[model samples]
Target: MQKILITCEHGGREIPEKYGPYFQAHQPLLETHRGWDIGALELYKKLVAAGADASFFSETSRLLVELNRSLHHPNLFSDITRQTAEVEREAILEAHYHPYRKQVENAIQTFISQKHSVLHLSVHSFTPELNGEIRNADIGLLYDPQRNTEKEFCARWKQEFEKLDTGLKVRFNYPYRGTADGFTTHLRKLFPDEKYGGIELEVNQKFPQGDKKNWEKVQQIIMQSFYAAVK
Candidate 1:
């Protein structure tokens, strides 16, 4: 048997009320891609909306703590948050980061424990322009090129997506490296090639906010193609 899990690491831009003061002048930053992945959480909802048997969840904000990063990763905290005391940063780690990672890790562990092959899709969105660099990909599927199962799955997925919309730009391992340190990458350490496949799905923020109908169409195409490929 096989299963799918969808998750959004940078979901919302919420700074807990207790820590709101720390981000006083940075409220606008929260609204932008830096704080939380624009449209990622909402898109997560759409992907799993059909009641798929997926263990899905959303993170509050990347600014508070980067859920994608490992325990010792330096970029876990943004510049503003890096200024906080060690105790405060540890609190953020304990309060939010670890639990989220454990939840995902446990989900995979449980599925594979039951002798099920798992196909996990960690949902995310990237800014169109970052530091004056324009990102041309409309959708990015990130998976380890060394993992033949994952690599082939993404290739078939991209083909299916392009079949739906010929003009849609689907790239593999664009903007960021697929094998980069992330939740999926961490899971790979525990599960071998036969039991697990992790792919990070990155969509451009423009679709979610740019047009109402187009966004919905893109959402539908993504879900449809994903199902088709996995089937």
Candidate 2:
């Protein structure tokens, strides 16, 4: 059997009370793409409600500690938190980062033990334009091309999404590499390819940043297309 698991690492831009002081001077940065994936949580919620086997999300601002990034990754701590004391940084990781990733890891382990192949979808959003370059795809399906299961699933998902009349662009591994140092990449090492399929579903911020109704419609189309691909 195949099971679906959803996660949204950069769901919200909420700064914890203890960490508020560190981010006070950088409030504007937190409001930008550096803070969080704006519409990711909303789309994640829709997927969960549409019947994902399990789901997890961190609303804490990535500026505090990026949940999507691995611990040793240089970008795990944003510029603001990087200046904090080492002990305090460890405390932040203990309180926020480790717990969320551990929970998802545990969940995947449990499902694999039950003889199920897990399709782990990590939802994220990208700025429509980054570093003076405009992103061409409306949706990016990221998966390690070397992993056949992950690659095939993304291909099918993209095909299904493109069939919709929504006119949204869908591409594989844009804006960022699927094999990059991220939560999904880390998990791929812990589980065999046959047992785990990790894909990062990246949506362009333009959709959610625009009119509300159209955003909701986009969400519906995404959810519907996923079901079709899964079938």
Candidate 3:
């Protein structure tokens, strides 16, 4: 049996209360798409309530230290905190970054050792429009094309979504590429295709950022699609 592990990296826009003073001037940025994934957390909650085996999240805003980005990644820190002294940055890594990654890595190893392949679904949300370009997908299932498991899973997942809501625009890879630098990609190096399948579920912010009724509707559709696909 495969076990599902759900994670929402940029779930909250909260700057730790201790770090609040450092982010006072950057309040506006904290609420933008740059701060946290707009609706990823809510979707994550829905997934958990729907029976995901495990779920993890960071309540701290991504602006402090991006959870998705690698430590050496250029955009790991937002403009506001990037210039902080090395000591402070290291503190953030110790307090926030390392622990999350370690916990996830350990969890995957434990599961795989128990004879169950692990499916990691990292939930995220993207802005409807970036720069002047309008994003064209309602939902995007990102996975490495080179991995047969990833490729086949996404294709069936997209078909499941179509079955649930035929009008929904489910894109293969959009807003961002799956193979690009990120947490799941990082895990691919550590876990093989047979033991681990990592996928990032990117939902356009338009759903949860829009009307409450429609957002609830979409969430239902997502769970229904999951059940259908698994069947």
Candidate 4:
């Protein structure tokens, strides 16, 4: 049996009460793309409603501690939190990071133990334009190039997207490489390809940042195309 697991790491820009002090002057930054993936939570919710076997999300602002990044990654703790005492940083990880990751890991382990193949979709959004360059794709399906299963599935998904709407450009590993330091990359190390297939679904922020009606339409198309792909 194949099971789907959905995760949205940067779903919201909520600063914890204790850490709110650090972000008092940085509210503007928190509202920006750097703080959270703007439309990721809504998209993830849509996926959950589409009958994912399991789903997990974190609303804690990435600026406090990047949930998608590994502990050792330099960007794990943003500028504000990085300046904290070493013990404080450890406490933050213990409270926010470990629990969320452990929960998802345990869920995947359970599914794998049942001899079920798991397809983990880590949902995220990228700014429409970065560094003055416009990203060329509307949706990006990222997976490790070396993993044939991941590669093949992405190719199929892209084709499905095209069938749904050729106008909606879909690309492979565009905004960011799948092998980079991320939660899905960490899970890939723990779970073998035969058992776990991890793909990061990247949507262009333009849709959510634009007209509400168009955003809703695109989201519905995404859900439909995804269901078609998995089948």
> Number of the top candidate by TM-score?
4
Predicted structure 2, TM vs. truth = 0.98
Better model by lDDT: candidate 2 vs candidate 4: 4
Query: What is the TM-score (0 to 1) of candidate 1?
Result: 0.97
- For model 1, what is the error of residue 83's alpha carbon versus the real structure, in angstroms, after optimal superposition? 0.9
Please give the distance, in angstroms, between residue 223's alpha carbon in candidate 1 and its true position after superposition: 0.8
* Candidates ranked, most accurate by TM-score first: 4, 2, 3, 1
Q: Pick the candidate with the highest lDDT.
A: 4
- Evaluated against the true structure, the overall lDDT of model 4 is 0.93
Q: What do the candidate models score in CA lDDT, each in turn?
A: 0.88, 0.92, 0.88, 0.93
- Deviation in angstroms for 101 in model 4? 0.8
List the lowest-lDDT window of 10 residues for candidate 2: 158-167
Error of 3 at 173 (Å): 1.5
Off by over 4 Å in 3: none
Residue 178 C-alpha lDDT in model 1 = 95
lDDT of 1: 0.88
Residues 1-231 of candidate 2: C-alpha lDDT, one tens digit per residue: 999999999999999897888877888998999899989999999998998999999999999998988888999998889999999999999999999999999999999999999999999999999889999998899999999999999888888887885488888998789999999999999999999999999999999999999999899989999878887
lDDT of 4 by residue, 1-231 (tens): 999999999999999898889899999999999999999999999989998999999999999899999988999999999999999999999999999999999999999999999999999999998999999999999999988778888988888888888899888998899899999899999999999999999999999999999999899988888888888
What local lDDT does model 3 show for residue 13? 94
Instruction: Quote each prediction's TM-score.
Output: 0.97, 0.98, 0.97, 0.98
Give the Å error, residue 77, model 3. Answer: 1.1
